[model samples]
Target: MIKLEQINKYYSLEEETLHVLKDVNFEIKEKEFVAVMGPSGSGKSTLINLIGFIDKKFEGKYLFEEKEITDFSDKELSAIRNKSVGFVFQNFSLIENNTVFENIELPLLYNGSAYTDTKARVQEVLTKVGLADKASKYPKQLSGGQQQRVAIARSIVNSPRFIIADEPTGALDSKTSEDIMQLFQDLNRQEGVTIILVTHNPEMVSYCDRLIRVKDGVIVEEELVK
Candidate 1:
């Protein structure tokens, strides 16, 4: 559902230009479970941000479902992102002071969804992530796994067609990380949510249907395990 061609991202310092991504190219199909693996400074996160529409200052063509979004304005990009994409960060970017329910409800609230509709949607996603019972709890009250579930619920509450997850299990222990990955697997299988995950863990690559390896901002190799 997403494609990038000849993508190049450069950052300008005071006297030097840093190239984060160089001629990157890839395509992710609908309902595909793809993993992006690489070492530090590999531009994996940079590519994620570009695809997620959070950063658009790169040179290249980006097409989502055949529509070129490279030159979309900020407002247009926001609308597209809100309607088409979801994000799960390693840090579980929850509002520390908000309850789980509140955190999940924030997106709908910002989108101006009706209160009744938002309530039902939030509850549904919370239950999907197995966090229904923890809805009233604050972020600090939940364990790492639970917090990540909340983050997942928040990400998927809008029923996004694609999800971009950056090191989704990075902060969790091994068991918890496995659980989280399983949750992602189930989401892909049951809901057909297209997932592009960035991870460094080789073991985690086994869970994905396809793997794309990046080095020095380019796709060096790819494997289809399933």
Candidate 2:
């Protein structure tokens, strides 16, 4: 579902250019679970952003579902990114003031989904992520795990084909992290949702089927974990 060739990313520093990713190349198939693992500053998140179509300023070839992403216009890219990809971040990125139901419903609202259909879809994903009872609660009212679950629910409510998560469990305790990882695993296996997880935790990486290790902005190793 994804293809990258000769991918290169860099950032300009005060004195020199910091090469974040150098000649990166890889492909991820449909329904595949991939773990992007590396130490801090190794460009794991940079690669994730590229794959997610959120960072398109770099130089490379990127294809999604056989179409060249680099060739897309900004509006075209935005359309596909919204309709095809879901994102979860370490910060949980939920609206602090909005109720869980409202937060999850925001995407559909923006996409102009019909009120009835949005209601049904929001409820479905909420239940799937064990947040059905917390629909009316605000993010601050929920614990960290519950908030992350809400984020997960909001991400999948639109039925995105790809889930790109960065440090998904970084803020949670070990047990909660395990639960979150299991949720991602079930989504990958049962729902056939492609998952690209960028994590520093070995336990989280174990949840994925493949691991791609990054260092100095290059993919140094790839391995099958399951």
Candidate 3:
């Protein structure tokens, strides 16, 4: 459902043009669970940013489901992002002040759902993430795993075409990380949710269908998980 051709990205320092991604090319098919891994400063983040539609200043061709993303206006891109992509970061990125239901409802509201109409959809996702009873709680009141579950729920509440999970387990304990990974695996298997996971932990790749390794601004390896 996603394709990148000859992708190249750069950053400008005072006296140097730093190339971040070099001739990167890959395609993620529908319902595929893929993991992107690299050391620090390896450009995986930059690569995912472009894939997630957050960055347009690059030299490459990005086609989403056969449509050229580059052709979209900024406003159009934002709308596409709101509807097509779900993002889960290392930090939960939830509003500490809002109830879990409120946090998940934000996306629906942004998508034009009315306040009174958001409860059912929000409850549906909360139940899917195994947080059905915690919707009334606040982020600060939950464990790290619970908070991350809320974040994942919020991401999928919009029924995005794909989810970009950047270090979703980075902040959790090993057991909690395993639980989160299992949740992702279940979601992909049962719901056919396409996930592009960016993680530093090699162990995490065991749960993904494919592994993509990046190094020094290049995609160094692509292999099936087996």
**What is candidate 2's local distance difference test score?**
0.91
Ranking by TM-score: 3, 1, 2
lDDT of 1 by residue, 130-181 (tens): 9888888999999999999999999999889899989999999999999999
Candidate 2: tens digits of C-alpha lDDT, residues 12-123:
9899998898999999999999999999989988888888888898988898999999889888898888889999989999998899999999889877787777878888
Query: What is each predicted model's overall lDDT from 0 to 1?
Result: 0.92, 0.91, 0.96
lDDT of 3: 0.96
Per-model TM-score versus the true fold: 0.97, 0.97, 0.99
Which residue runs of candidate 3 sit more than 4 Å off their true CA positions?
none
Give, for candidate 2, the lowest lDDT window spanning 10 residues. Answer: 110-119
In model 2, the runs with Cα more than 4 Å from the true position are none
Using lDDT as the measure, which candidate wins? 3
